[model samples]
Target: MRFSDFALGLGVAVFGIAVLLHVRTFPEIPGMQYGPAFFPGLIGAAFLICGVALVVGSVVRGAALTERFAERPAWFGDRLAVWRAVGVVLSVVAYALVSPVLGFLLTVALLTAGLLLLMGVRWVVVVPLMVLLPLFLHYGFAQGLRVPLPRGPLELLLF
Candidate 1:
């Protein structure tokens, strides 16, 4: 559904302000010029500025406060688009629910392969991506970033 520029701007401004307030609660590092909150605060400030600009621009252009939701086309008007969106969402949800049981490698590989196939990708290309991508991401997160991912029976045997 479409929203009026003014409504969008107001919503964005409120979200930005909320982000700013939330980020302010992050603990500061001792003797650091830039702390944990620095990046988030910067993003919040940018959002706030952009939101204010949008609000002012909309007002200057004499835009309405709201748009007619019923005038918009049905969300599922395009069958392929709707199906693709649903497929992606379902794949991610399945990955989340099944990952702990099936492990990250198997679950993500299957999810990637399934999504690529859904998007009409060739099995030749899908096969390599399904295998390599999950391994690469696992290594990056588990080794490089030191973040632990869920490990199932297969992962336990291998790693």
Candidate 2:
């Protein structure tokens, strides 16, 4: 659905405030400034700031809300765009459903490759992205974030 900048900004700002308020109720760990809510709170604050900025910018520019929208191409009217969007959504849903059986790395790699292919990306570029992106994400979440991702038989054997 389309929304004016003012309306969108207001909605985002409200959402951010709600997030901030909800996160405040989480239990804080002693001797640590960061906790489960830390990242969420930061994101909420960023959203609030960006929303306010958009609202102010729109007002200051003296541009009508409809004028901003008129500059954009017709997304829903395009057949290719609709197909691309559907493909992306299906890929994501398939990844989620298959991840437990195939493991995060394998499932994500396949999904990425499929998406890249759908976007008409070259095999050379798609190949590296499919291989590297999953590994990087796995390392980042498993090691950096200390959050373990699901492991299938293949992942169990390799790592």
Candidate 3:
């Protein structure tokens, strides 16, 4: 738990620094209004505060925390779960990289396909989901949130 606290604290510190750098790039708004950096800065500060609280709480309660977050053994017993987490992280990274080039819908479709395939889902089920998830996400994000996503190579085919 102490080690977790140390790691989280370090991560939060680094994230806060990153947010600060981003904030510096934006021009200040007039009339005390919020600027582009407002939300990200707020989120970064929240992360920093939560991290500090976790470290402090861990210090106060460390002796009493006998069971690690879950009851499973540390190493080999949880290897599969750890690998799944790693796969998810990699998938997200892949989506981020591909989204600009392949477009949001295609990237999301690929992400869904990869995840479903890795989870042992059948191709019949996986293929439909791969096609549907991206369409759903595109509508949800673009129509619902009013945020536009890149169309990339599929723009002509889609629109």
Candidate 4:
């Protein structure tokens, strides 16, 4: 846990520096109260602050935290969970790469299907979930939030 805290602290410090760099370059846009970089800059600052706190807390409670984890069964130490997590991360990367080409509807639906399958959901349930989720998201964002969705060939065929 000490190592985890150290890594998180280091990562957040690096991320904060990266965001600060972009915010420095972000040009001011008129009429809006905040520029494009405002929210991300805020988040990066928050992350840096929280990371420092975590590192300090970890140092204070180091021995106790190590004892707690040591009490857990050896079976819980299986590192395969990390590989499984990597697959989920890769799935998101795949979605980003394909979203523009496949468009929002198809890309989101495929992502839902892939995630459900990865989680061991059967095809019978996965199919309906994959189809309905993207439609639900479309309604939630496009209709409710008044956000326009990217339309590709699917729009031409469906609507």
Using Cα atoms with residue i matched to residue i, what is each candidate's TM-score against the true structure? 0.56, 0.52, 0.52, 0.52
- Model 1 residue 136 lDDT? 96
Tens-digit lDDT string for candidate 2 (1-159): 576677777778888999999999988999999998999999999989988877777788775364444234478788878888999999979977999899988898999998998888999999999999988998899879978787876578778
Better of 1 and 3 by lDDT: 1
Q: Candidate 4 lDDT (Cα, whole model)? A: 0.75
Residue-level lDDT of model 4, residues 39-155, one tens digit each, is 888887887787777667667877424533224445347665555576689988987788778888888888889778777789999999999998898889977998878766775
Model 2 CA deviation exceeding 4 Å by range:
1-73
- Report the lDDT tens digits of candidate 1 across residue range 1-159: 566677777778888899999998999999997998999998998888888987888888876554431244476698877888899899989988999899988899989998999888999999999999999999999889988898887688889
RMSD of 3: 7.4
Q: Record all residue pairs in model 2 with backbone atoms less than 3 Å apart, i.e. clashing.
A: none
Model 1, residue 112: what's the lDDT? 94
Q: Candidate 3 residues 1-159, lDDT tens each?
A: 124554556567678777867787888788767888888888878777877776666667763254244344464467766776777999989977888899888788888888887776899999989888888878888879988887777754876
Query: Where's the lowest-lDDT run of ten residues in candidate 4?
Result: 64-73
- Please, what is the whole-model Cα lDDT of each candidate in the order they appear? 0.85, 0.85, 0.75, 0.75
Order of candidates by lDDT, top first?
1, 2, 4, 3
Poorly placed runs, candidate 3 (over 4 Å) = 1-79
